[model samples]
Target: MSISRRNFAIGLSALTLTACNSTLGTTSNSGAPKPKGLPADLRPHLNRDYAAWVASFRNRALSQGITESTLNAAFRDTGYLPGVIKRDRNQTEFTRTLEDYLSIAASDERISKGRAAFTRHRSTLEKLEQSYGVDAEIICAIWGLESYYGDRKGDIPVISATSTLAFDGRRGSFYEKQLIAALKILQNGDITPSRMTGSWAGAMGHTQFIPTSYQSFAVDYTGDGRRDIWSDDPSDALASTAAYLKRSGWTRGTKWGRELAAGETASRVLQPQAGGPRFAVTGNFNAIKRYNNSDSYAIGVGHLSDRIAGAGPLRTPFPPDKYGLTKDDRIALQSRLTSNGYDTGGADGVLGPKSRAAIADYQRSLGLDPSGDPSQQLLQTLS
Candidate 1:
């Protein structure tokens, strides 16, 4: 995903932040309510203005060389997904500290899953590394982060998603371009419109490539005629990611970076968190950034890659957050809260919305201010 599209997905919901894809489907365009098994926010909402916008967009798409047949097939069942617009507009600006990011990105579960995925796909990944000169673990790490190793390759139809965003007009031009690219992909017979499902932002497949990126970098590594990334097999998606990284200047043999031990020095060093561990990075680090363009994202990929390759967690501890709660303290707070009949949604140490809501409920029950901030004071109170 492009930085703008990826950032647009941030903070809308925990699912959007942590998982790029959902298996939910939208309601049909027939104006009949159907049980789609989707959350209310994710269900399609009818809008006349959206209909009008799509009508106008059809002309523009045709002018841009999208075939009429392709347009009709793509839009036959597609409708304006208000949930997509809600996700786009409701993105919070909160930036996670590197500590919080790593805690989620390289969590024990994610690391374990990455290793299993790497092993499961070892033959394919090693071949990709040989063919593309990008690290197999790096590709696997990207897969883990993008769509949870293909567990959540999303189920939202791409035409509906991209067209809805293009009509919403927040980042109209960009999404319009993406919409056109998606149409092109459809016209090229890679996949049918119904099978072309992806994230709400139209980032598709195991590695979550937006339509434009897919057009530029997606490949048919399976030797199949189609560049099918949304399939049960992840070979094409993984190969596409490797190709993207190689084209983005990944050095053939250099490591992305490593957590710097005491007395270690490098020409380039990054300390994304003030008192967190520093990393010695290489040009390959920049290459990883070209995929997502966030220091934390790149570090998360590199660190997760290292963990998948049998490396351990960072030795240095992160300083306490602004609320004076270290990661362990936060984890304990969450664990205690959950035990006390409040669901903090698992003690991952990152006090996300669910944990905060649980904390606020606990505080309110005691007639304390419902400020959701976690602190040592709160930890002690819970104790």
Candidate 2:
């Protein structure tokens, strides 16, 4: 969920622009094979062999009642965009500390803007929650995080991005299906190709809905007969996110989570292997994770929502070791531990039990007290 792999826009505007710097083959008029010598990370499915992929996708779209003309317009001149693949590949690979992720995604400026949005759209938001059983703060938080309240709905052409990823072998089937789904959106006369721009991975709207998520969850809250998530109307986007959560098993009238006084010196109560956190996180928290798999992402959205709703910060420190650590730094430490034979499971920055065990093993190896506190000294040692 962290944008460390990307350079996003910063400011308070109704519209934002973004550009991706990556290596991928573009669609050539002559439809030649992909040029060789490209980095493995940047190489895309070449045009020479892209026909079968395109044909398969075209068939799927046509089966969905999408016409050939719409498909052609969306796919023609589209290229194998490397930036899209890069962003997707990097989405969950690296770990990030809570503080660092919040710094990028849920800053004070974003919170202020979120609060303002909540107030400005109070009537509509209230109606949405009343109908959908979701909170306005959660919606605002999602909006702010996704596109900075509609300021930065990315400009990459979804068709090219999805098409290239489909042709490429990495998660090729998934992206290929998404590419067809996108064409179906166009064929249905839902939105224009020109207006169908989004993240390199095809996430669009104020709350970054992927093509499939949009198809499954997007709604026309304004009764416009079109589910236009790309429009300035935040209602549809907010409602859609709420709907996604609702369908994903969000429990109404319960908090996402509460801060807990996790004990000191590696208490069993604070450890991730304890099975779950002392603080009770409701099912809605899981629903947030459905949007993104990372616990840190769910926590950020939940905590930011609480903040926007005029709630205070956590009652306890998010355990000691997480202090003073940024998202990437935590990931780096986890990576080091993993490489050193400490199996942290993933490089995700959260100091889960596995990471703590790794830390303990590392400390024991170094002849230090194996408390697994994630202390500043331990971090320094790891560095």
Report the C-alpha lDDT of model 1 over 1-383, residue by residue, as the tens digit: 54632444545223223733455543566764433655666666678999999889889999999988999888887787878887777767778898888888889999999999999999999999999999999999989888889888778878888988898888899889999999999999999987898888888889888888898899999887999999999999999999999999999989998888877889999998998899999999989888777888889999999999999889988998888888889999999999899988889998888999999999999899999877788889888
Q: After superposition, how far is residue 143 of candidate 1 from its true place, in Å?
A: 0.2
In model 1, the clashing pairs are: none
What's each prediction's TM-score? Answer: 0.94, 0.68
Model 1 lowest lDDT segment of ten? 12-21
Q: What is the Cα-based TM-score of model 1?
A: 0.94
| Runs with alpha carbons beyond 4 Å of true place in candidate 2 | 1-47, 51-60, 86-92, 261-278, 318-383
RMSD of candidate 1 to the truth, in angstroms, is 2.3
Give each model's clash number: 0, 3
CA lDDT scores, all candidates in order: 0.85, 0.67
Best-performing candidate as measured by TM-score: 1
* Model 2, span 87-143: residue lDDT tens: 555554344445445444555677788898889888888887888887777877878
